[model samples]
Target: MKKILVLGAGYVAQPLVNYLLKNTQFELVVADVHLEQAERVSGNRARTQAVSLDIRENEKLEQLIEQTDLAISLLPYTLHLQIAKACIKFRTPLITASYVTPEIRKLDTEAKEAGIVILKEMGLDPGIDHMSAMQVIDKIKADGGKISSFKSYCGGLAAPEANTNPWRYKFSWSPKGVLLAAQNGAKFFDKNQIVDVENDRMWEQTWPLQVDKFNLEAYPNRDSLPYISRYKLEGIETLVRCTLRFPGWVKTMAALREIGFFDSESQKSAEKLSRDKLLRQLLHIPNGTGLRQIFKERAGQFWTEEIEERFDWLGLFENTPENRHNENTSAIDFLVSLMIEKMSFAKNERDMVVLHHDFIYEKAGIRHNWLSSLIEYGRPDGTSAMARTVAYPAAIAARFILEGTINLSGVQIPVLPQIYNPVLQELTNQGIHFSDINKKI
Candidate 1:
């Protein structure tokens, strides 16, 4: 069995460590900045070793790599370039959950020269979403269909019963990354045109969608146009979109935007306040302050009443007594900490991932619609859909590398049938499957 070393001990890392510890023959070594986390996952397994170290230390990483064959990184996205550099230098294959960074992309030839596989974007959005969308596109094209427009929306949400919070959002995953994406607007293709924006411009045309009695308002999330080129839809003029939201989410998000929660720019008082302090100040804005108060105090007001209502309904406004010292903080800052506060799953409340995709295409002058939705609930073992969607695809990619299923070396994203078929099937078998229904376009 090949020896694999995994870096990081966060949510994604835990599921991965658990998966490898049980299923694979690979000798796994788990490393983390938090020794207890590494220890918790490693236990007493003979093939597993847990340790604390500054991974940026080149000499130490080199020492660990002496006995390691495959390096799996679950580190934050920014660390990918440095990790990729190390993998290339060591002639070791590395797989990460991050999107392909420009620096890492530039190393394709060097990695290929070193005979090392550097796979990226194999996690949730860039991972499963890419593979699944490609598979669907391939099927549509193969079936004599001309692609028209495509939209994919996936969100890791707290189940209704478990979602006591107003935003219906919780940080079962990374908080910083979540904030970054939410701050960044949705990008997509629409009206036979390619478009990208930070707001619910897609909700202007709401397609009523019903699945298992769950009604959702569809909107686009990121740059959906590139997928046309990436998925090889040359003959077709297509609009693509992806969204992340809860029911009636667009209006609430719009309210937030009206209140200014989407701003990534440094605030006017940021020079006097650190990021944390700025966040605290934002949270300190009272419930009834309204726009005049926001404009008077902060530079903007982008959040909505729904968010405030959610907070009030969730009892987030009440004094927990535990966090009582923070009376003057902003709701956003309080939310930041609150997310992490209950990020882990409760024993009875399940976490779920809802992934919805709509592909509009034409075949033989017939306009046809294909709608696919995937819903995966949290494991009884305390894993969230966020972790599963992110980690499983990554592990599958690693499996391909270990089993010699994907041998073309270089920096790459998983889009091929060889990469998608087995992983998708396995994921389906493991409670991740998409249901497709035909409709008139």
Candidate 2:
């Protein structure tokens, strides 16, 4: 029997593992640094086993790679290169949900030569977003329309009923990952000119966006210029990619940025301090001064009672020893810890994922506007919408590669028809499809 090796059994791994076990005949091994985490997902099922794996152990990783027909690295993006090297050495196919990096892209030639596919960006924003966008782009071009403008935005948040916090959001995935994304500089085309936004100014660039009846705000996501050629939108005007969040998030993030929550050097300086002291150090508040007044002065226009309440509720002002952990933890680390502890969903509460795309094209001298959107809600059974949207597409892609349905090799994403068409169809079958509308302008 063929074998499959899965690395990193985290929040999203269970859905992917369950999908594979139910749909395929492959023997499976779910490995993690924590054997219990791997075992929790593997469930002692037939042809499935759980094992401990510290990815740093190259020999064991290679041995497992050599034995499996394919390997899926659900490990953190930083660790994927090591796993990829092992897979390439053993001529084993590898898949990941993380975005493709330059180092990984450079391996295309080597991966192709090894006769194995190294698929990246197979998760939510990078995965479903690519597949869904390409489907529409391909169809519009096939119909002889020229795309003049395209914008896409995606977000994961607490479902309406579950949004009880002052921040109106909760962690469905990595809190640190979400915070790190805010530090990214972005570049995108607007009206035929490149608009560059530095990391510090990202939140300042947001504008309110209406997706169906849900009012939200959007700020540019990472670099979008490279995707013009990738999406065959060369010479296109007004192309942008954005990250969505509920209203008030942008202003709050801007305040956080101004207050030094995202500064590593400053965070290091504030290390070993209690939460309130850390906040004081970051804000330069004098001892015995009022936090509200000092914070409001520092936050300036971003200051609001609701934002203050959010920070207080997060325990940022707490002086208790309970708020301190790992004396060496930095301010950012403390904030992430607080978010993970205080912002996690309650029992029976669910999260939501939103993806929206808008397009403008011209065909036969007539202009048209196209809109495509997807809104997914998590199950009461504890399966998060983030997990489903992020893992399901990757699981499907893995099956296709193993079944020889996706014949091409080398570094790849899921933009091609052979990959996107069937995957989109299956997603719809799984009740996670989009709503699209086209009309003359």
Candidate 3:
């Protein structure tokens, strides 16, 4: 029997673990730094073993990889390279939902020589987004269409019924990932011109958007210029990739960022500081002065009723007890902690994932405007939409690799037809599918 190792049994691992166990006969080893988490994911099921593993232990990681036919890394992107090296040494194929960073791409030749595939970006935004868009792009070209403009937006948000918080958001995946993404600058093509957005001005580029019946806003996600070649859309007049959030998110995030709340520097004295004290420090307010009063005076344009309400709702102005656990954590760490505490989904609360693509093309002298959109909701059984969408694609791809259905070796993503076609068909079978609508204008 083939052995498959799953590294990092975090929020999304449950779906991937469950899907593999249900669909394949492979013996699974679910490992994480936390024994409890690994055991929780494996569920003592037959053909599964749960083990605690600190991935930093190189020898131990190699020992595990050497025994497995394939290793699926769900670890943070920073750790992916370490995992990749181990897999290459063992001649074991590896798959991940993380983006293929330049450093990872550098492993392509080594991976090819080893005769093993290193597939990355097999998750929702990077995974399904790539597969779905490429499917449409390939179809358009085959139909003799000339692509003009392409815009894509994706987001994981609280379902309307579960949108109870003032933020209209909940953590279905990594909170730190969301915080880190806010620090990115973005670049994209607009009407044949390149537009660069600095990190500080990212929120300023947001625009309102409507997907299906829900209203949302979008801001550039990150450097999108590289995708012009990846998607084979050279010379396209416009190409933009963005992230979506409910109406007030951009304003709240911009205000917090401007207030030094997103600062990545660690504070040695943070262990003794409570939220109110930190708030006072950020706003330069004196002790005994009302936080609202000083905030209004110092915030200038950022001070708004809604922003203040969101801040107050987060308990940032409360004289709460200091968290001694903070130790040397940074301001952004505190923000992530607070969001996890305040914005996490409650039992039975559903989360939503939305991916929308807007395309303009010319075919036979007629211009066509097309939209491909997908909306998925978390199950009532407490399985999150984020987990399902992010995990299933990777899991399905892993199955194909195990079955020799995807035999190509080297660093890869799901953009190619062989990878996207079968994976997308299975995704539809799993009830995660996109709807495409087109019109002539």
Best by lDDT: 3
Give the RMSD in angstroms, all C-alphas superposed, for model 2.
2.1
Q: What TM-score should be assigned to candidate 2?
A: 0.95
* lDDT for each candidate structure: 0.70, 0.87, 0.89
Q: Cα RMSDs of all predictions?
A: 4.7, 2.1, 1.9
- Candidate 3: Cα lDDT at 60: 92
TM-score of 1: 0.84
The estimated TM-scores of all candidates read 0.84, 0.95, 0.95
**How does residue 162 of candidate 3 score in lDDT?**
90
Q: Summarize candidate 3's per-residue lDDT along 94-193 as a digit string, tens digits.
A: 9999999889999999999999999999999899999999999999999999999999999999999999877778887558878777778899999999
Q: After superposition, which runs of candidate 1 have C-alpha atoms over 4 Å from their true positions?
A: 198-209, 248-307, 314-332, 339-345, 439-441
For model 2, the stretches where C-alpha displacement exceeds 4 angstroms are 265-275, 281-284, 318-326
Please state the error at residue 218 of candidate 2 in Å. Answer: 0.7
Give Cα distance to truth, residue 2, candidate 3, Å. Answer: 2.2
Candidate 1 lDDT, 1-441, residue by residue in tens = 788888887778877776776655777888888889888877758788898868778778777766688888988888778778888888989998787777889999999999998988888887888888889888988989888677677777777677766566666655656654555555565666655564445446445555555665565655666666777876555555555556656655455445555544432342444333444345445444543345334423334455556544544444333333424444444455665665545576778787877788989899998888888888776777778889888877776678788776898888888788888887887677888787875
